[model samples]
Target: MNSRITSEIFEATAEPDPEAGLFLNVATNGLAVLDRLGLRERIVDKGHRSPHLIMWSSTGKRLGTVPNGPARDPERGSVVVRRGILHHVLRDAVREAGIPVTFGARLDRIEQADAAVRAFFADGRTADGDLLVGADGVGSPTRRHIDADAPSPAYSGLVGLGGVARVPGLAPTPEAQHMVFGRRSFFGYLVRHDGEVYWFANVTHPAADRDALRAVTAEEWLAVLRELHADDPYPVPEILRHAAGELGGYPIDDLVHVPHWSRGRVVAVGDAVHATSPSAGQGASLALEDAITLARCLRDAPDHATAFAEYQRLRQPRVEAVVGYARAINRQKRVTRSRLGIAIRDAMLPMFLRKAADDTRNDWLYNHEIAWQGSPVGGRR
Candidate 1:
C-alpha cells in the first residue's frame, strides 16, 4: 500500500518466512481487475511470496502468528510486486488506449447538467463527459462537490516513517513481513531475498502538518527511531543504523465515513470515497476492485444515474466493512502502555488467529469473485 517502499516483486502470502521476516497476508484481491486490463498474469508471474505475519511484544516475545490470508496456496501464496510496476503497467495500458492524460490541471469546481457533467479547472479548461468518474483520491474536490458539508478524514494520532535499507544482518526473505509492538511505537520490516530491507515505524505524534513533518532531518528522526526500538530487539537498532538515506514520514489519516459518493452525474471511487488506512494493506487492492465494479455497473446499467446508484449500493457496504477492519488493526498498531491491556491483547490475538483458520471466516471478503455474466453482484440493471 505504501508508495515509498517500492521494489520488483515479493511474496505477500499466507505463511511467514523465518529467513525473510514477515508482511501482511496480501492476497490477489484485485486480480480480476488487472486481468481486464491484461496485466494480472504478468504481475503475478513476477511476484513472490509474502508468507506470514509474526507479531512480537516490546521485549521481543513471540506473541502469535497468522497466515497472510486464507484459501491461498499454502506452498506459495499471493505474489508481491512493487507499486511502481503496477503504475507503469497501468500507464502503458492507458497509452495503448490512446487516452489523453492532462497533468498539472487543478480541478476547481463541478458544473453539472441534465445530459452531462463538466469539470472546471483553475486554468479555464473544462472536460465535459457523459459521466465523471472521480478517482481523484483523498482530499478530492470531486468528493467535496458531491457534498460540500462532508466531514474531512479523521486523524489517527500517529506519524508513519519508512525507508528502504540494505541491512546485512537481516536475512534475505522477500516472502516474509515482521511486525514488532515496541515500547512506545509500532515497528515493521521485511527484507527481499537480496538483503534489501523495507522497514517502517509508526510513532504517536499529535502533529498533522505535512510540511513541518517533512522538514524533520534523517539524523533527528533516526535518533527518535533509535529510542523507539532501542529496547525491542538486537537488529532493530542495527537496521536503523544502516538505513540508506533520510526517513520519510507522514501523518496517518483515514476516511471512515463519506456523506455522498454521488451527486447528479458525478461519482467517486476508491480513496475518493472510502480511503482505507495503510494498516489494512488493502488500499490498492480495494481501489482496483472498485474501478472494475464501477465500470461493470456503468456498462450493465442503461443510464448514468442508474449506474452511479448501483455502483454506490454495491460498493458502500464492502468498503465500510474493510474500513472497520482496518480501524481495528490500527488500534493494535498504536502505542500501548497498560500492562493489563498489553496482556489481554497478547492473549486474544492468538485466539483470533486460531478462529481465522476457518475457511468461512473471511469468505465475504477474500472470496469475492468478479462475475462477468448473469445478474452479477450488484442491484438490478
Candidate 2:
C-alpha cells in the first residue's frame, strides 16, 4: 500500500496483479488510509481480525492477549499476503506509473556536478538525473557516497530464522500473531485459514561471521532450533521439525543512528538510511511512507536542495523513534535466553501487555498521517 498514493498512481495502478491474485492475510498498522483511497477492495479480510496478539510460554500455557491498543491498533487496518506478492503489487504500481525497474546494475562509484548527478556502475553502465534516490537497502552505496562517515548497521545480538509450512489440520488464527517465549530463545508462528503457517524464531547467541552462517545447513540449524524449543510449546519444535524450503538465519541488525539521510543531490530512503528490527512491523510501512513523502517534497519544493532537506528533516525523527521502539521489542523477544530472565519476563508480561492496551493515548508511532498533496508535516524541528 502506498498509504496515500497520489491521484496519478492510484489511477495508473487500478489493478495490481499481486493484490488481485494472492489470498493470504497479513495484519498491519495502516489500512484505513488505503481504505479512504478507495483501495479497500484490495484488502481481503477473509477471517483475519485486527489488533490481536497471542503469546505462549515455553510449556504451552497461554500467557495473555492484548485485545486492542494504542500501540497495536490502527484505524481499521491490517492487510495480509505473501510479501513477495506484495512486492509484485508495488512493482505493478511503479510499472503502471511508467517507471522501469532495472536489475544487475551494481553501483561502482558516484560522480556529481553542479547541474546533474551521475552514477557509474560496475557493469560499465551509467545513469544520470537531477537527483538520485538510493533505496538499495541496508548496504546502500548511495548512503556511503552521500556521507562517507555514515554509521554501519548495529547488530542486535540476535539471530533470526523464518519459514512457511503447510499443514491441513492447522487452523487459521486470523490476524493474531502467535509468539512463543521459549526458555532459551523466542519462537513465533501464526496459522492462516488455509492451514499455512508462517513462522519465525530468534536466538540470542553469540554473533558469528557471515561465512559461519553460510556454513550451517538448514538441517543443522533446525536441529539447534529443536533443542532451543525442545522443552517449549507444542508447535514450537514441531514447526521447526516441519520446516520447509530454505531455512536461513542472519544477525538482527539495525541502523540506530544514521549520520546523514540526505546530502546534496543524493537522498536515501527506507532501509538505506533507517533499517529497523522486524519486531515492530513498521519497516515496510515506514519505507512506503518515505516513498510518498519524498515524492511530495520533490513535487512541491522550489528547489532540489529544499526538497532533499525537507525530506530528511521530516523523516529523521520518526525513523529514529521507531528504531528505539523496535530495539525495546527486540530486547523483550531475546530476553528469554536466560532462565532468570525468562522467569521474570513471563511473570511481568501480563503487566506489560496491560499498560500498552490503552487507546486514546495519542500514540504517534502508528497514527501519523501523510499530507499527500501539500507540504510535508512535522518538519518544524
Q: Name the best candidate (by lDDT).
A: 1
Q: How close is candidate 1 to the true structure, as a TM-score?
A: 0.85
lDDT for 342 (candidate 1) = 70
lDDT tens readout by residue for model 1, 1-381: 111221111111323222222222235566655776788776665455664666777777766655554434444344456554565566667667666566657778889989977888777877777667778777788899999997788778788787778876678765567788877788887777777777888898876888988889978898899877788775677888887565667787889788688999888888889987777677777788788777777777777678788878888888888888888888888766777877777677667665443344553555456665675853221
lDDT of each: 0.70, 0.69
Candidate 2: residue pairs that collide: 25-80, 26-79, 26-80, 28-78
Worst 10 residues of 2 by lDDT: 5-14
lDDT of 2 by residue, 175-252 (tens): 577878888888877787778777888888677477898798878888888887888877777777777666668877
Candidate 1 deviant stretches above 4 angstroms: 1-26, 45-48, 75-80, 354-360, 378-381
Tell me model 1's lDDT, rounded to 2 decimals: 0.70
TM, every model: 0.85, 0.86
Please give the RMSD to the true structure for each candidate, in Å.
Answer: 7.7, 5.2
